[model samples]
Target: MKHLSYLNKYFLKYKWRILPGVLFVIISNIFGVVPAQVIRNAYDLIVENAAIYRLYEGFDRQAIVYDIFSYSLFFFGALILFLYLLRGLFLFFMRQTIILMSRHIEYDMKNEIYAHYQKLSLGFYRRNNTGDLMNRATEDVNRVRMYVGPAIMYAFNTTVLFLLVIYFMFSVNATLAIYALLPLPVLVLAIYYVNTIINQKSEKIQEQLSRLSSFVQERFSGIRVMKSYVREAHAQTIFAEESNAYKTNSMGLVKVQAFFYPTMLLLVGISTILTIYIGGEQVIDGAITPGNIAEFIVYVNQLTFPVTMLGWVTTLIQRAAASQKRINEFLQLQPDINSGSQEIDLNGNISFKNVSFTYADTGIEAIKEVSFEIKQGQFVAIIGKTGSGKSTLANLLMRMYDPSSGDILIEGQALDKIDLHSYRSQIGFVPQEVFLFSDSIKNNIAFGLDAVTDEQVNQAAKDAAVYQNIIGFEQQFETMLGERGITLSGGQKQRVSIARALIKSPQMLIFDDCLSAVDTKTEEEILSNLGKLMKGRTSVLIAHRISTIKNADKILVLDNGRIIEEGTHEELLNSGKAYAEMYQNQLLEEENV
Candidate 1:
């Protein structure tokens, strides 16, 4: 019922088209009823009255033959033409209405799912597979459209057509009609039971299918790494296992479908046999005319068709129900990060007050009771070893995840109180792993900005030290980057991402080990450019190398999810603590080299 309610809006939108289509269906069915009546009348004329020729005896024999031929041809021809025209027109409108409704419903579902995804905390994505989300957006939405479009219409038509045929049958011979319909209730119940089983199996099959898609997507994305390690055979074996699982589930569904169709056919056949035996007995006993018996048989066959379609409609509904459940689940998910109702200008003054965070799945604190403040336009550096929570801190600042305890503030207002779009628009993030869409280099660099000019894109690329690289490509800025910038080298991809962030001219900038792929010389040059760019921006640099943070106004060294040391470069070196030890080790390694 809830799923049916979901389709009300779509139905209302197409009611005009649907109304005419349905009226045409009724007219077509009326024409269909005419054939049964014609058969009845033909049987009466031929068998019941041998004196049928007496009426034409007074006319010339040739004239009678011609008149009968002309009348029969014109009457049957017109009836057939009317039926065909009504059926064609109804089908035309029905198809157009269903297609339009399908497209609109699919569009709405995709947009809603995407918008909900945007509102969800990063932790949700971290725990979910990319392929699974893609499947929900595409496959699940398509299933919903199928239900709202064809399934609903077919179900309604089948029900209505079946009831109308049953009413006519009963009107002709009440006892025979009741006997023929006795199996209908049992058949319907059987279909419902079969549908329930199919729905359960289909849900499992869809889950397995999603897993298969995820496995394929992951393996393909990591194909280069697998080939580099000579693990092609191993990857293939894993993929085969997932594919086989999908096949196994699909075959299970097929088995159920196979049994269901045969069972429905048997039920319809039995009902037809029963109707014939009983109606034929009545005709021989003079309880009904031969024409009436003929009409009953025709109506019986018509009833069987709708019954047969009942099985298919049930199957479609079950499949759609499974899909709807998955879509509803996604829509119902609530983001952990609350965007509270308050507005404030983001001036880049950030403060962390006793903040702590844990990954949702593991519940292991990644950052513990960390507190810090960066004044507006300050250049702050966070130095940490692998898994020391530096990236997690940056994530908190971006509102990707909220702290498990305590609070973070931007410009003297709670982070939660700020509008997410406004706050995020004011900040730029360059992640350790650069991501580029399959688009022209110029477009990639100017991704989030509105209608940027080529000159502005080139200047931003130059600032990020990537303009030379772009110009060397065959198409320069017009060159399309392959998926995830696969056609570009690691350093070039990183620089392009940097240019994308820089083009935004953000008030706050976060570079999370974004320079790791670039060579030392290029890294130094880009860093020099960044120094100038950071003059009036609050910038946070997460780095492993001491050189990257030496010029920072303040440096915080993190160890094991806690800040172990904090001070200026000279102050940290003079303290002879963790920061000094790290700096001294790097210096000794350089001297040895």
Candidate 2:
């Protein structure tokens, strides 16, 4: 019952529909006893009046026997037909409403989890792998639905059916019914033992499946690397190891299921033997008629099937409970980031006041007590060697992460105090590793906009200097790309990414090394267009090429997580700082080439 509370939240919302379905299940099971009763009545009528004996002493056999027998057969026939027809209708409604309700629950659960994933902070994803989350969303959700559909429906059906059969069996011969059910305690123990083992194994099985899924996902995502390195054999060897683990867990579960069914059948066979042996003596002692013993056997047989089904129903419930627990834990995750409600009039004035941040996993500072200011509509460029905190600073400006030690300000208001969506909706950010959805060129360009036009997409592409390359394609704007735009050349992909950001016409744009893929000629062409894009808006450019940022209104040169150089390119060259050396070295390399 404690475990059921988690699943009930999904069920309670549909109680109105579910309650009626449950009522139908009960009615259907009660009607299931009709044919056996018809058989009992037909048998009793034949044996009691087969001949003119003491049992038929009062009735006139010659005059009334033929008419009475025909009437009896005809009435039972019509009654059995009507019972089954009505029962079938109830069964149909039961399946329709309850089974479909489980599907609705599955739909809601998957959507809720995906929405939660969207809300969760990046750190949460860092800790949990994609395959683990995907398994919970898909497979675990499906198992939970099984509980709401078949487990609940069949458990109710078996309970109602067993009760009705026992009541009728008692009326015919209580002693025989009790005698036949003597092995009931053993059956109960067997079910309990089997379900306990199944529940434990099911959790292990689910974990192994997730592991196998993760291995496949990681391998497929890096298949190009595997092929480049010729490590396909290594991948196969690792896959075989994971698959063997999954198979081992599956076999353990199968062994329990195999033991469970046979154990139930063996107990049922014992019940049948007891009924036949003891029922014969009862008939001889005149405690009950021969027809009464026959009815008792029919009731016991009927009860045995539902009793046997108990094992399967219990197995489903046990598996579902394990799955529900996993789902409940996922639903309970609280995102590390939360949105603030206050909206501010943003004017793109950015400031960082003694900001410092250390990643949670590694307590080494990524950005150390950095301070800077950029007035509205200024083109501020950040240049540093790899892992020198340039991208971290850009990410902070995007509000993807907050400063660990100090506050960031936008237009004199604290960055965290302003509404997250309001602030982010006005900023365009393109990361170092560009990602594009697998869609047509037009749709990919217009991704973040609520509504878009072919004119806007084409203009943005032209501005990013990729328009000629796009039109050269067979489908132009309608060309479909592969996953993550893998079909496009690296420079083409970067330009498309720039186009995606530019179409938004954001108040501020953060380009985190976005031009790394293009040659210097193409970089110069794109930078010329970017000058127009940045004229009246704040821009933050992070690049390795000094030529890219040399024309900026201001450049901040970072070294070892500290802003050691700042001012115009001319000022840094005269000062002979780290920036000047990087510029001189690039010239020397070009001359040597």
Candidate 3:
């Protein structure tokens, strides 16, 4: 309930509908109880008229009594039918108000969650899996919706119906009402015990299901790798293990649930028997009539569904509470990276002032006292071995993270102070691992822009050395890609990513080993094309190969999260240091190949 308090605002937001829905529940229950009273009156009328018919001796008197009984029965029956129909109409209105409000709240909540997901930092994603995130947004929200809609609706209905039925029963005979309701407390306790077990078991099953979903999604996404490794049998065995665990948990819940219905029916049966027995005693004592026994039975049965619903509603509330707790955990999170109010154009003069950063999740220092500068139009390249923090530098420049110590400036302005969206819009970043949506090649290339022409797409594709390959496809630029662009080869994926960056025509461009998949000749061609396009724009290239950055205005050699060498290509070649050795070793490797 503490966790569910977050929904109070939404309840208040739709109070108009909720209030009317509440009114309808009460009205329907009022009509609902009136039927039992109608039955009691009709029963009494028939008995009294039958007595009169028995006393009368003439055939005409008997026939008239029979007609009176028949007409009264018809009138009462029609009235009962009309009352039930009217009750059903109000129930319909109740659902229209409450259930419809739940749908609207669900939509708003999903959007809020998705929007919050986007606001979250990369670390949040790193610490959570996609499947759990998806389940919280979808499955959890749906559970909460059940609480808001059906559980709430049924709870109110049960309360109102119970009150009305009990009032009518007590009005007739207090002793009979008490005897009839004796079994209800035990039913509630049994339901409570069972629901607690169901709640615990349900959580376990939900967790296992999330794990199963994640395993399946990952396996399908990496099916190519699995096939190459021939691990289908192994994958199936693991999947079966997860599935068996899920089934075990589910069966545990089902076992407890198996007790739920039988206990409810048994208690209800006891209540009905008690009502008949007690009402008959009262009738024999002259405290009530035969019609009273009939009415008490109807009242007892009327309470049965609502009492059964008590258990169900409790389960729903528990599930909703659990889900809402999970949702609130994320909703309460404040993004580590906050966007600034300033929206300004970036000229792309970049400076890293003794910048140092450590990955919070891994606790690995990815940068250490790194200091460098790039003039607005100069091209700077960073070369490093594996784990040398080359990509970290690009991440810093893109403002994906802020430095643990010191600062970064863009156009002589603090990077974090610039509006994140506006700042990112001015820069083009191509990452080491390429990702493309399941969209057309043309749309993928022109992703960030509001509008683009085919000519622009073609030129960018040509510049990235992927135009010929795209043209070879049956649908050319219109060919829709598979997941992560599996339709393209690795080199084509990299080039398409490059084209996506190039199409932006940004003030700054950062390519983080984006050409790794292409051959040397194609890499050179793409670099040559980029040189022309990169004029008067600050460009930062992070790569492993020295050949990729040999012509840069400045080159920084990194090792173990520190810059060990800084010089021009010619100077580094003659320096007889780390850079020189790397270049000589790379040249020999090329020669050997």
Candidate 4:
């Protein structure tokens, strides 16, 4: 019930639809009861007593014809009219409510899931898979929608129909009705058992489905890597294993469901047989009228259908509940970093004061107590070997993850105090690996803004040295990039990413080895343009080569999550430390070439 309570707000919002649907159900049930009354009346009048034939004796022939026509017309016409009105109107409204509710629930659930994803720290995404998140956003939300619509409507209908049938049955013959319902307890217990199994199995099935989805997504995204390594067979074997696991779990659930429905029908069939035999005896003994026996049997049969439907509804509800729990858990996760009370005023200066960070999973500090400061309009460079925490430092500045201890300040305010969205808007990041959406180049470049003009997009492209490349294409800016911009080469993708960052016109720019893919000449040209771009902004460049950072105002050399050398390039070279060794090694390689 607590899990189901998540739907209460949506239910209230759409209660108008639900109310009409409920009214329709009630009207349908009332009309449904009329048929039972008609059966009883027909049995008593036409079968038991012979007085219905006496009306023809005293009537004129034409009048008798008229009377017969009227009687026949009234009985059949009324029955047909009520049946049509109840089934058509009631079913229509019920379907409409379900459709509306499903859409509303799907929209709201997806919105909430997306909002939660945005709030979560970067570490969460690092640990989770993109395909699993996509599944939650799409498939999981759809599961909730199914429950909001068909599952709720059918459950409500079954409950109301059952109660009405039971009421009518008891009214006809309490003793016999009670005897007929003797199997209900057993039926309910069986349904409960089936539902328990379904919930457990369905949860496992959903998990496996997520894994399979993740595998397919990863394989497709990394198809080139897989092919390059010739691991196609291995990938297929892994995918098949996941696919088989999903199939086995789904089939196991089906096996349980197979037994459940048959058991329910068998129990209900026995109960119906008992009702007829006992009711027939009572009728023969004159304890009950034939009409009463007929009505009781009709009502008992009515009860059976709802009971059967109720069992299926219970199973759906259990599966939906399990899905809801998984979705709700993700929705409930609190972001590790969020805006504090103080507001941010960006003047572009960034300061790291003894900052240290350790990822939750590894529990080893990725960045030690490193301190650094970049004044406004400074072009500072960070050079490091692999695993040197240079990228981690940039992540902290971007507020992707807060330091486990110590403070990072931008302008004069602590990073936490700044509104995350507003603060991030003022910063641009081009990661070591560039990611482009499958969209037009223009759209990708202008992604940060709500509205982008063609001129602004063109100018940004020109500034990033990608304008010539775009114009060379037939569609130019309108040309669609394939998935993750697969149509573009590495250098072209990097340039496009640079254009995207430049279009934001951020106050702080962090380029994490973004120029690594381009030739030295193009790199030099970009760096020159970037120098002009960084005139009134603070910039941090994370690079591997000496040429990339040699001209920076200050350079910090890092190794193993600690800064070993920090000074101007010439100062570091003269200091005769790790920086000199790296510079000399690169120079030696160049000379050999």
Residue-level lDDT for 463 in candidate 2: 88
Report the error of model 3 at residue 483, Å: 0.6
- TM agreement with the true structure for every prediction: 0.94, 0.95, 0.98, 0.95
Structural RMSD, model 3? 1.3
For candidate 2, report its TM-score: 0.95
The Cα RMSD in angstroms, rounded to one decimal, for candidate 2 relative to the true structure is 2.3
Query: Lowest lDDT 10-mer window, candidate 1?
Result: 46-55
Distance from true position, residue 21, model 1, in Å? 4.4
RMSD of each: 2.4, 2.3, 1.3, 2.5
The TM-score of predicted model 3 comes to 0.98
Q: Which pairs clash (backbone N, Cα, C closer than 3 Å) in model 4? A: none
**In candidate 3, what are the lDDT values of residues 342-421, reduced to their tens digit?**
88777768889999999999999999999988888898999988999999999888878889998898878888888999
The positional error of residue 288 in candidate 2, measured at the CA in angstroms, is: 2.5
Ranking by TM-score: 3, 2, 4, 1
User: Could you give the candidate ranking by lDDT, starting with the highest?
Assistant: 3, 2, 4, 1
Local accuracy of candidate 4 as per-residue lDDT tens digits, 1-593:
57767888989888887888777777767777667777777667555334544555575664666566568657865875777677777677777876787798789878888988988988889889999999878877787787888888887787787888888878777888889889999987887778779989979988998999999999999999999999999999999899999999999999998898888888888878888889899889888777877777787777777877886777778777878887887888888887766656566788888889998977878899899888988889999898989889988888888899888988878888888877878888898889999999999999888998999999888888889999999999999999899989999999999999988888888999898888888888888888887787888999999998999988988888888899999999999989999999999998999
* Clashes by residue pair, model 2: none
lDDT of 2: 0.86
lDDT of 4 at 554: 86
Q: Per-residue alpha-carbon lDDT of model 1 for 137-233, expressed as tens digits?
A: 8887887787777776677567667777777777878888887887878887888788878888878877987898888888788879999999989
lDDT of 2 by residue, 1-593 (tens): 45657767778899987999889988887787867777777777777766534445666764577677778878878888888898899999999889998888889889998998899887777777888889989998888888888888888788888888888877777888888889999888887778779999988988898899989988887888999999999999999999999999999998899888888888888988998889899989998777776777777788777887888888788888888788777788887667788887666798889999887866768999899999888888999999999998987887777778988988898887888998888888888989888899999899989899889999999989899999999999999999779889999999999999999988888999999998899899888988888788898899998989999989999987889999989999999989899999989988998
